[model samples]
Target: MTTSLTIAQAAEATGLSVHTLRYYERIGLLDPVERRDNRHRRYTQEDLNWIDFLKKLKATGLPVRAMLHYAELRREGNTLESVIERKAMLQAHTLCVQHTLAELQENLAVLQRKLVLYDELEQAARAAGARAPRNSAPTPPTPERMAP
Candidate 1:
């Protein structure tokens, strides 16, 4: 098996654009790539695997600086200490993601309630007719306004 891939081949295999690969290296998200005898960049399968993890981190909203820090930890050593450090970082991020998900679910419930109320209001308005003057316009439904 060919253990080394040129930059273009790496890009193709990884589904990352060549420019993105270069940018990741420049931004410290990736370790420096090795160069061929002709000075072209070559990536090993290990590099490809690491890029895959970087893609996961980026997709999951890990900030660049934090990701860079994680990269630094990896470069320094792959000891038990580094494993704990990486797990801690991921554990923190997972908690944050969980909180975000909970908030989103609560918001979705509010939206659903508002939609039902809106449908009811629309039906009442049609029954009352457009020409029916109101004493005052309906109050805006902020989250606070939706109180019983």
Candidate 2:
């Protein structure tokens, strides 16, 4: 069995498209690719690992350039402080995303409550020999007319 994989095979393994792989290389997101016969791109196990790291960075919502910076630092060789700094950046971003998610959840709960209230109102309207569609717009508050 061959140790290296073709571009298409690498893309499938990495969950990225062949075009994305090419773009990654072109944009310096990936290190220079090793080619066989100067034509076919072949990926080694290291490349696969790099792709995996890139995927994790993407999942964490890091921008491509931010990931590229991390990749560049990583390629420079392992350093304790650099790793710490990168981890800090990711952690901060994760905290921010979690906060946003919590806010959205709260908003959703409020909207659900409003929806339930609307449903009750609709039922009451039906019982009173009045008819209106569910989710009908609420009346807008009007300003009192100014005395002449």
Candidate 3:
């Protein structure tokens, strides 16, 4: 027999807060979890595996709406149309992730260039006899600079 996990155990296994797990169910990201006769939720290995994939999607920057749509399609049962749609969505998401990685790489290069500029600015200011600000790093990287 397959051993079932308690909600607490699921949370620990998935590195998700208990509240987040409940929220996932509420948002339809997860199908309604099975419950024991006394009303405690019992999760199976399948559930754990699904949650792991969800985490990967999230980490890769898939939005909630897209994930929700994927879940809805998955719950529609095993039909050829549904499988095709799921494949299409996953392919689209893969392209989106690739774009994001490219953007992140470009943004990082801009940040590095800006840092070098700041260092030069600091040195120039010091050469002219004024102390430059000690910590002038930008808050975060963004692809705002126009690429040449």
Which structure among the candidates has the greatest TM-score?
3
List the lowest-lDDT window of 10 residues for candidate 3: 139-148
lDDT of 3: 0.93
- TM-score of the candidate numbered 1? 0.69
Candidate 3, residues 22-117, lDDT tens digits: the string is 999999999999999999999999999999999999999889999999999999976998899999989998999999999999999998999899
Residues 1-148 of candidate 2: C-alpha lDDT, one tens digit per residue: 6599999999999999999999999988899888998799999999999889788778767788788887777777668878887778778878977987899899999989998999999899989989766888777645554334
> Could you tell which candidate, 1 or 3, scores higher by lDDT?
3
Off by over 4 Å in 1: 3-9, 12-16, 127-148
For residue 132, what is the lDDT in candidate 1? 38
lDDT of 1 by residue, 1-148 (tens): 6689989999999999999999999998889999978999999989999999988888778898999999999997889999899989999998988888899999999989999998899889888885436676767779787788
What lDDT score belongs to each candidate, Candidate 1 first? 0.90, 0.85, 0.93
Ranking by TM-score: 3, 1, 2
Better lDDT candidate (1, 2)? 1
The residue pairs found clashing in candidate 3 are: none
lDDT of 3 at 87: 95
* Cα RMSD, each candidate: 7.4, 9.2, 5.3
